[model samples]
Target chain A: MFNYLKPNNLLKIINKTQKFVFIIFLVIISIGLVEALILSPEDYKQSDSVRIMYVHVPAAWISLGIFSLIAVLSFGILVFKNKNLSLITKSLSPSGFVFNVIALVTGSIWGKPTWGTWWAWDARITSMLLLAFFYLMFLLSWRVTDDEKKAVKISSYIAIIGLINVPIIKFSVEWWSTLHQPSSVNIFTETSIHASMLLPLGIMTAAFALFSLLIFLMKYNTELIKIKNKGLDRL
Target chain B: MYGKKVKLRAIFILSIFFSLILIVFLVFKSLEENVVYFKSPTEIKDLTELTSKKIRVGGMVKEKSINVNQSEVNFVITDFKNELIVNYSGSVPNLFEEGKGVVAEGFLKDRNFFTAVKILAKHDENYMPPEVEEAIKESN
Candidate 1:
């Protein structure tokens, strides 16, 4: 088990996985794009515009997922004082921010067709905007702090505090009457989803996952390289 | 040295964990039930099936279609090809007007008219909202 924990060994695993994930990612994205853009049946009601769901939903999911991950990683760094863990968390922040912005922008784009307004203060929409701001606050904290350890600690607290918004965003429809529609993705629901639409959505999501992984790896590797160069400079 | 090594290990593990979550999200999102798009009457005629499913419809307000009775407002939406009658009973946007592009969100009733929960008016030239532009372009 300890042998499995070695850095070189772990790096080897990551490198191998990256290659396979990259291929899977490419295939999934291509399939999803084709399915979403062409194969999926036009919505019985919305016609072709329903295609936006493929992009909007995934972007929203990724943004939320990324923020949650960042918070968890930040917590680990603060509680354990792990340098590399902190670096990884730091590296992930910008990407998380990008996804959050994408989610908001895409949601608005989708909204204009459905809501008749580009922006609204509805519970769901407002909470998501708050989540985006939480990400921005975490990113800004790093820029303001000179001490890495202090920054990690403060950011971790901020992340944990910000997590309160996630649940609010999720349950906004039920807790309060909002113009935004309620969740239709619940596992307990008995709705029948068509295969043609499902397939493309699945493929696109896979592609997005792969794309995020590729970005995280590239960013993490750059961070490692930067630290190594700093060490060399010390010599 | 052990501390540094552990830190490196944590980074690897966290990255993998995050990646896995992303993969799962992708799969789940694709499988989830999706919201239907809103279409103009002209676009709806081209669809293969139509029944009780939720949808959005958009078009310009015909000049004589507006009928107001207290909070409820009834109007007809035309895409220059087909027309759909719409009924709304909520606060309207300032820009809502006749002969202007509008999108109404909701579903069609058995009565052969759209019952809108929300209504949006299109902005001006060189500055149309992305969603409005996308919906308009998509129907064409």
Candidate 2:
């Protein structure tokens, strides 16, 4: 089973899976865009500007979700000293950073028309900005260190430290008075959103998740190629 | 030996993770006042003394309480229990209306009145088609 984890075998698996993931991502995103933009209902008050929620909400969720995954994987690396897990985290951060930027920029644009201000130092917004910085630090730790062991150790510590921000970001609105409203969708309680808009949101979140998977596969495949070029047999 | 080392490392990592959470939890608790984006009208009304410091008061705009004049606009902000009259001299956001959420940024004149320099419309979490909203409004 361990021999099956070699770069040559992993590269073959990645190559086959990447193409299918890309195709699926493209199909889901196309359907999601149509649903979010064309079929979703215009907001009662915000009008067309509310459409930004489709992109903003999903992007925010993806960024937060990826960071939490990275934190958990980093914990695994710390305990088990898994080399492959570190590589996976290194590949995942770029897509996570991109989505973080998309969420912040789209949110700013949404705020201007609705809130009468482009930015506010509200709890939710500020914590999200901190999360972007945490992603930056985690990405930087990987590049700034030369030794593989050093890079892995430094990045793992950074992730663990950053993990604290994830819960803070989630509960920011509930814990403080934020310019942003409290969550309308809850799993345990009733959801305030109408089904028409909720449908688009759900579809868009699925599409974004698939798109992130495509990015991760391509990135992980490249890492495998590099290892194969270096004449390494296993991670 | 290797298994024992890994076990120790796992304990170390979990301890570190929990401690970091504890430290941050305390820090956020300490900075509670600063993190609050706005105060409600009820909170303002409960204040024993009013200060001229710039603050944000947020609540629903009372129906039939908005009075617009050439120089300034006055409206009452209500939390359904306590109400504060706000005077502002600026353009309001598009979502500002009676029976809607708002946050006024300015100074407090007294316990019952606030002087605002800027008005921000706070939108609720509800989203639906305009027709559906209209129907809901009619039934109300």
Candidate 3:
């Protein structure tokens, strides 16, 4: 069973998939950027500023999406006793952290002109902050633990525990009265969004998803290489 | 040794399972309410009808329109052609001033005044915050 699950075969598949996905990501991003910036109509009211949504909303979504993936992967490792799942979740951490930071920073920049302040303790903002803090705690824990396996186990637990906040962040606007507006896009209801606007949003979201997959593949490959090298050294 | 390893893995796995469940709960909860967009005075005027539902209003401070009392601050937000008078009772941003763009989040009780729960000032020409920018764009 272990022989059939050879790392080399998995690595080859991941690399090939990553390259293809990367090309798709770039194509979509270029189209999204051009459409969002040039072709999309300037909002009747916001004029040029509406373009920020092309970056802001997508980044926000990716940040949340990555964390959700990490939480699920972490849980799988802990419950199923799968080292591979733990490794994948660990590999996802840096990219997840980077995207979350981007989301928060970009959000603050967009908030200033509309909200009157750069920062607020509103439900949405505060919950995101908490998410960021959890990420930091996980990263710091890695540094503190000397045993690699111990670190992985502890971080996985932390990731799972922190998962509780994801909902609080998402629903912060609804559960409690918040200054942050509620979500515009939902699966069940038809959106009132204009085609021009929706096109760029869709494109950017695709780009972000592809970009995340590409990063995950690269990181996982690097970890695999490191593990192989260690095995060779022991031999 | 195998038992120790398994125990560690179990704890890690259980934590992740619980977290995933929490995330699903949060995402569903967040979907319950629609995020409201902020509209400027000019934008609002062109809209078909006004709903009593909560929304945000964004615009620039009208020159000389600010009236500040001990705790309350009243001002007018103008979007070139139209203006809405806003009454804010909370702390104001440092950059809040005449002629700068701002967003007030709350609801309109009547056509005359917007009672704001939060006031966000649009800072610097090139550097309006993301939330404010998104709000202004979406509402338009």
Candidate 4:
């Protein structure tokens, strides 16, 4: 069953669904924008500046989510010899790196008004910076070598090693006395964020997830085309 | 064959190097004093000995404690367990307010008073509309 999802089948599926994915992305993003900017009330303290959270938080979430997925897929690639997953981990990275940069940039912009500093060597901020470096090193591991076998092994190892920083980034605020506050959005317990704000945040996160999916489809299709051009029947 | 060996060696070395870095970071995390961005007023008071080095004392600015004279500002940061007086002459962050979270950065004058050079406003995790906040306040 898994064999049927060969590179050729992926190409066909990608071409058929690309436009629909794009349309859905656009529609969700539009709704997200309205909900985040207008419908959500201004924060009692931060006021209009709080609106920046709509983009910053979603971008951070998407970046972290994508990296976690890549790490898991890399683990399969190394241990189970699932070569097909390498293409996925490869294609997923550019959007992940882009969102990582977006999160950092937006966080910097948000910090200037709230924390009175554009940047700080705070624990959470530094760990996030380290994650970006990991993403960079993973992306570079592919280009630095032309041999696909070498590239896959090196990149997978990098992913597995970099995953140690993920939890550190998540808990940096609680572990240390950082400038950033504790997370309000809890999963196991009641969330501190109000329903009005969480609603927009959820929509924005969905839109961003769809957008990353669209990006992945295009990149995956291109990789498949490359394989087909080389007369390779399998990836 | 020689080139292949070199490439393999390079990959081996790189993996070891990255793994070592992660291990070092994990080991370093155990030592908390080196990493804290700021210390609460109570934590500062509990210290066995005070260092002359610059440190940030963080907590809530006690209500009615803010005294602004010209460019100088004085306030008391309390953790509800202990309080520290901070005197500084600086333009504070926009969010700085009485009864709000704050962090003062400067050298300590003594155990009870600090000579601050900068004031940063800190906020809680709670976020809501002004109206909603007012209503909650009224209901309370």
Best lDDT goes to which candidate? 2
> How far does residue A83 in candidate 3 sit from its true spot (Å)?
1.2
In angstroms, the error of model 3 at B107 is 19
Each model's lDDT comes to: 0.69, 0.90, 0.74, 0.88
Which sections of candidate 3 miss by over 4 Å?
A: A1-4, A232-235, B1-118, B121-140
Provide per-model DockQ scores.
0.06, 0.84, 0.13, 0.41
Per-residue lDDT for A124-156 in model 2, tens only?
999999999989998898679788899999998
Q: Put down candidate 4 lDDT per residue, B14-43, tens digits, no spaces.
A: 686577777867786676786788999888
Looking at model 4 chain A, which ten-residue stretch has the lowest summed lDDT? Answer: A1-10
Residue B109 CA displacement from its true place in model 4, Å: 1.5
| Of 2 and 4, the candidate ranking higher by TM-score | 2
lDDT (10s digit) by residue, model 3, range A73-153: 777666565767766887787777777888888888767655556786566887898899888887777799899888887
The predicted structure with the larger TM-score, 1 or 4, is 4
| TM-score list, all predictions | 0.62, 0.96, 0.67, 0.92
Off by over 4 Å in 1: A1-19, A232-235, B1-72, B75-140
**What fraction of the true Cα-Cα contacts (under 8 Å, chains A to B) does candidate 4 also have?**
0.65
By summed lDDT, which 10 consecutive residues of candidate 4 chain B come out lowest?
A: B1-10
After TM-score superposition, the amount by which residue A92's alpha carbon in candidate 3 deviates from its true location, in angstroms, is 1.5
Q: How close to the true structure is residue B79 of candidate 1, measured as C-alpha lDDT?
A: 75
lDDT score, candidate 1, position A219: 72
